[model samples]
Target: MKVNIPWVVGLTIAALGAAGLGGQTARVPGSDADPASCAAGSGRITIATGNSTGVYYVMGGALARLVNGHTDVRAGAAETGASVQNIRQLVAGDYDVAFSLADAADAAVRGTSPFGEPQKIRTLGRIYPNYTQIVVRADSGIRTVADFKGKTISTGSPLSGTEAIATKLIDAAGLDELDVNRQRLDLTKTVDGMKDGSIDGLVWSGGLPTSALTDLYTTLGSEDLRMIDPTPLLPEMKKKSAVYDTATIPKATYDLPADVPTIAVPNVLLVRDDMPANLACALTTLVYDNRQALGAAHPAGKDIRVDEADRTAPIRLHPGSERALAGLTSR
Candidate 1:
C-alpha cells in the first residue's frame, strides 16, 4: 500500500533540519532527540504485517491509516511472512515498524538461531495475543503431535511465528519434523489443502476469529474438522520459552462444540533502535487515542489496552513510546 506524506509530515521533516528558536540545532541527525523538543518529527514509514488473511494485516492497515490520517507521520503496511521475517527485514532497514510475536521478538533481541546476533530493536508496545490453532480432519487419526509423524501437515509459511511455534510443539511432543510431511504453506492454501485431502492437518497461530480458520470450520462442518488440544505440551514449551501462555478457543468463536485449549503468545510492534523518540511517541499515541477506530477495523484491536501497551519486557520499550504512555496515565 502507498501512503503519501501529508504536508504536515513533510514540513516537520523540513523544520527538523533547521536551527531551533534558541540558536541550538533542532535535532542532531542520527541521534535520539528529546520528545518535547521534537514534537514535529515526521517522515514516511512502512509497517511489515502478516498474511493477507491474518489479523496482523487487518490491524496493521488500520494503524497505518491512523498514522497517515491523524499524525504528522505518514505510514503504510506491507504483507510479509510475519514475526521472524518482519524482524529480519526491519533490522535490514526494509521497514520502519514491524508486527512480530513476542517470543520471536525476544529471540531476535537475544541473538537466537534465526538471528545471528542481537538485533538493535525496541518495542512500541504489545498489541494482542495469538492463539495456536491445530486443526485436523476428523478421520486423520491425529490425536496428538506424535500422530503427525507419518501424516501430512501444514506448518505455516517459513520464518513465520506460526512455523516457529509449530516446530517447538512438534519437538515438545518428542516428534521430529522430518518424520512428518511438513508442508510450508500460507493459511489460504493450507485450508484448501485440508478440504481437498491433500493434507491431513495444519497448525496456525493467529488472533480470535481468524478469517481463514472460520472459513475452514464453516466449509467442513464440525464432524469434518476437529481442533486438537496442544495444552499437553505447555509445560515443556514454557521450559524452552516463557512467552507461551494458556489460551482457549471458545465455542462461540467458531461455533465449535466446545472450547479448545491451546498455547498462546503475545504480539508486539517493533522499530529499529535508531527511530526518533518523537516519531515513536507520536505513533504510539495515535494508536491509543484512535483505538476505537482501530477496533472497528479489526476486533483484535480491542485487545490493545493502554494499560498493557507498555508491558513489552525482555525487549526494551522505545523512549518515545514510554513518553507517550506516560502522557496517557497523567491525563
Candidate 2:
C-alpha cells in the first residue's frame, strides 16, 4: 500500500527542509543585500533530512518543493543521517537549512548533545513531534527495560538523533547502556536484524507512523511484535531538558492494541545565525503562505506556521523568521 506522507505526519498538521542531498548554493532574490532584508536571487538552497525511512526525509523533501514552488528561491532537500549530522553541517555552511530534533537542537545551542561547543544555529520554526518507538519481537521476552539485560538491540546510528533518544530511553527504563547488546545501525539494517531475530529490539524516534516501522509491524504481525510504553518514565526524561514530553502513538497508526505512551520531541527547521535575513524572511513567509500546498505533499508540513515560529527550543529565531512571525515579511 502507498502511505500518504503529507496526511499522516502530524496530529496538528505540515513539515520542511535540511543536508547531504547535493550541493545547494543560494537562490537569493536579485534585490537581497542587507542580511536583515528580504529581496531576490537565483541560486539553490539545500535542506538536510534524515534516515530515508523516517518522516524527516519525506517531509524535508516536501518542504524544499514547497519553497521552490512558492518563493522566488529554488530549493532542494538532501537525505542525511538526521539531527546531529544536519546541525553540524548546517553550522559549517554545507547546508542552508536542516531538520533537527528539539533535544539535539537544545543540546547544540547550549553546547550539550553531541557537539562540544555551542553551535550558531537559529530556528525557522517548530515543525512536528517525534515519537520514540521501541519495537521488540514477542519471543524476545523483553517485557520491561531491565529484561533486555543481555539481549541484542539496535541503538541507532552514530551522530544521529536516534542514538541520543535511544540512550536516554535506555537510561529512563533503568537499563545500563553498556549492558545491552548494542548495534548502532541505520533503519534498513535495523529492520533486517529484527526480522532475522539477530536484534531483539530496536529504538527509533521519528514522526508518527514511520514507513520502515509500518513495514516492521506488518511483517511481525500482532502475535510476534509489540511496543514498549515509556511514558511512565517521562519525568525522568524531562530532567534532561524541557524538549521532551508525553506523546501517544494511536493504535490505528501501527495497528497496536492501544495508544502507547511514549516520549515526544519536536522537529525544528534550522539555519545559521548568519543566514541571509531577506532569504530567511522570504522562506518563512513562503512556508506559512503555502502550507496547504506543502501539506498536500507531506502531512508534517502542515505544522509549519509563522504564528508558531518561535516554538523552537533554547535556540533563538533567525532575524528573518522574527520578522515573518511579526507579520512584517515574506520569503
The TM-scores, one per candidate, come to 0.89, 0.86
Off by more than 4 A, model 2: 1-37, 303-307, 328-331
| Per-residue lDDT of model 1, residues 205-237, tens digit only | 999989998888889988888899999999999
RMSD of each: 6.1, 6.5
Model 2, residue 86: distance off in Å is: 0.7
- Winner by lDDT: 1
Model 1 ranges with Cα > 4 A deviation: 1-34, 37-40
Per-residue lDDT of candidate 2, residues 98-174 (tens digit): 88888999999999857899999898777767888888999999876667689998888787898998888778778
Q: Lowest-scoring 10 consecutive residues by lDDT in candidate 1? A: 7-16
State the C-alpha lDDT per candidate. 0.83, 0.77
Question: After TM-score superposition, what is the CA distance of residue 183 in candidate 2 from its true location, in Å?
Answer: 1.1
